[model samples]
Target: MRFLNFPFLVYENILKHLEPRELLLFSFCSLKTRTLVSRMRHTPTYTIFILDKPEKMSYGFVEKPEKEQILLSWTWKKIAMESENLDNRTRLKLKDVLLDCRVTFHRKLNIPTLVCRCEDVSSRKRFATALHSHMCEVFHVKPEMQFKLSLDYMDELPYTNTVRDVTFLQSSVNSTVADEFFEKFHVTRALFSKRCVPDRLLKHSCKFLEIKNLFVDWSPWLDITLLLKVKCENIMFSSSTSVANDAHLIMDNFNLEAWDPEVDKIEYDEPVHDYCEELLYFLYDIKKYMLRSGILRRQSDGSRALDKTGSYCSS
Candidate 1:
């Protein structure tokens, strides 16, 4: 009678109540239970990278820097994965957790494509380079197969002789932090000739390569220009800041007289209101508040804002 089948939910509840070690043993009770209960939990995909701060290098030690610059702080933020099927609620939670943790760069940084929440230059570079290497070794996703790659932030290092199109999710045109990035990543037309980037990044790419956040400077006209650039055809640059009215902007901007009007109209009629508007707004707003306070400033105007309508403001 003890072996009679229990309701799936009842068995699942039993498994949940067990300890980790006990749960493993509990699974062996029935093959049906094993499969059902095992798959119930959400195991978030986490890419463990090396902790960068000089102190973190010493394994368990913490180092104090010569200057107390909060911007210099680093951490190991979560990188979005192609395989993870995280729901929107879970994704937002992950972003929150990552903002509080220190950003860590992976040891061997050149994964063809990376999706990280890290905002630091050294940390971002390290994560990309190390991820590239890891992908090559583990998943066999080599640079040769990397026809498109998007970095949340661009590092100053040269490509590993195999990458094609590089995209950065930059948040500003000029900031003290931007200087550190420019110093590291060169963006002469010779290196990354064409880019999957916005116009602001294009200007910086003339001298340095960095990606701009869509929310930081959202514009429908700009998005169309970026879409037509050919370099960014397959790029995903929509961020929350531009979600409100950017789609209309994209449609209006891309709707040309030369191309078939009906086809253009069809494309324009696509349903992306929520995808482009609310989600992006949520993503960008949370990120802006969590990362650092205050927007990058412009020396000429001395304004303290990050919107397209105003000049940059320093903290």
Candidate 2:
């Protein structure tokens, strides 16, 4: 059967019925076939968002971009959701996969976070490289695949020319693992959970990073000023009561020593509960600043507009 000669509408219907993997395979048959596939309204519709974990390889397909997320998991045993950790998205017990090494949300293009169970470094490298090559060929895409590695398994990283983005999730096992992973693969971002992110890793991770976005959660007492040395475009912190005390809304703005954040690209959600007079002063000042900055501008409906310069405030 000459699939190339099929009527465009017929091809569309057939393509629509194909599974995500089959669609990917069909897209790369020939030049004419590729063009026909690309012209079918949704060119790169079905994409694998997260495809990791060793024995229990977790993979998924996306029919709709953001709202509709369908997860397809493969395991030696049936999977089940057993518990929850509401305070932290990262801390959420995503199944009982314990041997999994690294969990990173690569900031390069916001790649899907991987929960990998590949323990041996050599096995991890081979599996990751094979999968990366296969996916890139199937999707007709460049090598922008992202993988997260820690100091423990740093020696296992493959030296292939795959455009790899590695993010080191600061772990409690040992915070000083940057030395093991940073020199090998391209380590881009670091997600901080607690206060024990060793001084060396924090200091070294940013020194050679090409791109950085710092994510801090439940680390209210984290020294905001230390970030000054770290070159980053954006910093995100989730305010929550931790061991140190109340979330002080730490940011580059905190170092500015002003009641207001004084920067356009800042995001602040109203504190879960008020901390003290200092917190009140901080919020009031930012509110006044936001109003004064955008009160003159009007939305399509003539309401005062904000976020012109990246100041996103939620009550």
Pick by lDDT: which candidate is best? Answer: 2
Which runs of model 1 end up more than 4 angstroms from their true locations?
1-131, 142-159, 162-167, 170-315
Residues 80-178 of candidate 2: C-alpha lDDT, one tens digit per residue: 323552222222121121223333333553333434433444444454455444444444444454433234434444446332233343443333455
In terms of lDDT, the poorest run of 10 residues in model 1 is 57-66
84-130, model 1: which lDDT tens digit per residue? 33322121111112122322334453111122344545544443354
Off by over 4 Å in 2: 1-11, 19-54, 59-127, 148-172, 188-211, 238-315
Write down the TM-score for model 2. Answer: 0.44
lDDT of all predictions: 0.31, 0.38
Worst lDDT run of 10 residues, candidate 2, spans: 296-305
TM-score of each: 0.25, 0.44
Note each model's CA RMSD in angstroms.
18.2, 13.9
